[model samples]
Target chain A: MSEWSKNELGQYEYAGGKEDWEKVEQIASLCEKFVIDEEDELVSDEERSCYNCRFRRWTKSAFVCMRR
Target chain B: MKIFVGIDDSRRLDGGGAGEIVSLLTRTIDEKGWGKSAIPSRHRLYPHPDTGYRKHNTARSFSAEVKEQYMEELIDYACVMIKSNGTSDSNSGLAIAVPERMDNTDELIDYAYRTKETMINSDEALAMAKKPGLYIFELSGNGKGIIGALAAVGLRMTGNDGQFRGKLQLGTGEGYIATVKEIIEKSHIEQVKNMDFENLGTEESVRMGEKVKVVLLDHQYTLMVFPTDRQHPRWQTSTTNMLRIF
Candidate 1:
């Protein structure tokens, strides 16, 4: 699994690359609020994965998980 | 005649999403007998560093086969829908164009590609939308969305760029796995191919994957698949991450 880091705003950001399908699924498996985002935003093949989560906000480099 | 409808910046952080609004608008067009609309494609725009977009910097666009007589009504309805749905804080814009009447598609395409690489001003977008059959209108706020709105249509017309706004249902089966022929019969996707662009044979079975989406490639809704280590399901649907380069 990839390590999760925090931005200046304290939002949790995934350390793995955008296409890290395995790591994304591992994260989503532990979170109950993993809501699938719009099709355009989804990077992982797992439907319920955190990479597909609605609360995640995309940035230039990586995405930040908005769920508290 | 085909009418390309594009919309951007039509929602606030607490409000409805731009994609849902655009989907509703397309559904209304069909219900009102305005046209037979296809699925909307979501195009990404340049993200602002200072003022963040609630979601990603993405716009929605689609094409409809409508009669020429109802063209004016269509535009009017779209503008009203966008304005009414968006909050006072929204900086929304709507762009509509008839490809048959557009003479400067190459210029529009160039501008559309540039928007992805750098920031584009609304003035330049408005200038491009001033052609005979092209229409660009500001729905609310400062109307900077006109740039992304117009660019969405331009990218769509390129026969490449953007992903279909939603997932495709391949019917219930053993999880997400299905034969290439079965997928073709069940969905509107034009074809299925591997990452290398080689078309998958009809008899071949592949995993549809969760949240399956097709990208607009070569003017077709193509479901791109990638090879897997397992031989049973030799191919799997390409994820949005894989298709993001488009």
Candidate 2:
């Protein structure tokens, strides 16, 4: 389950809580992915994960997807 | 007089590039001082977040919006014309001419078939043609031929022959025949569907002395199919000389 909050627009929003964040950290640790140098132009592993995340799918061009 | 003209291009099966036809018609209408008219731009006037760029290409989704804009412009022009002429009925009518090609005939026919399949399909094409005093004519033939005829009449050709290559050129005479044939076929189907089979059986069987009303001018042909009964007022020769004077 995800944590929920209400914004000024009276719309419900969800975000990962401490428990969810911990789970994500554990998953990353198990994956053993190496972080690139801070100065490197290469995309971080975390950014790639964000691109493939279910949350991204929900947010991708939200207005267009809403019609479908 | 207030006239609303809707020009469609059926030169290609995918509803060929109508941009040129629309441009020519609107320019002609404006030049003649008949009244200001326009065909909607392919793209939406205002972009919506949801539609993005998709709304720009497909006429099916945007036809209503385009038509509405055209009508609004027409109404405005009509109001002006009325004020100046002191009468609203002074030769006022709508004329819609579509340039179609032989290759696209099957696609257009299929479109008509699908439209007939659905009960909700309003007979827009027929209704547009039947608008009281409005004259509507759909011109179709070999796309290249029609364009070639236009070129032959001294309208400059912009592209290479390969690019503009259309099938056979149906000169004025052949074009008239083809137009008449199309009108007859359309009328035959419509008449059979609306009228009793037995009543039309005699006429259908003989296929003799089957005459359709058509006028062949110097460079253009006009086919007028009465939407209502035989005695009803027919739409006049508005599109008769469209290509002739060009």
Give stretches of model 1 more than 4 Å off.
Answer: A1-36, A45-57, A63-68, B50-55, B173-177
Candidate 2: clashing pairs of residues: none
Chain A TM-score by candidate, in order: 0.79, 0.24
How do the residues B34-58 of candidate 1 rate in per-residue lDDT, one tens digit apiece? 8899889988776654223244577
Tell me the spans in candidate 2 whose CA falls farther than 4 Å from its real position.
A1-68, B13-16, B39-124, B141-246
Candidate 1: chain B TM-score against the reference chain B: 0.93
Report RMSD (Å) for each prediction in the order shown: 3.6, 25.3
Put down candidate 2 lDDT per residue, B1-246, tens digits, no spaces.
232232222222112233444454455456655455422222101112211112111110001112323544543453343233222212112232222212222333233233212221124434433433323322332111111111111111111010011112222322232333333454322221111111122132111112222222221222322223323221111121121111
What TM-score fits each model?
0.83, 0.21
lDDT of each: 0.78, 0.25
The 10 consecutive residues of candidate 2 chain B with the worst lDDT sum are B155-164
Interface RMSD (Å), each candidate?
2.8, 22.0
Q: Which ten residues in a row have the lowest lDDT in candidate 1 chain B?
A: B47-56
Query: For model 1, what share of native contacts is present?
Result: 0.35
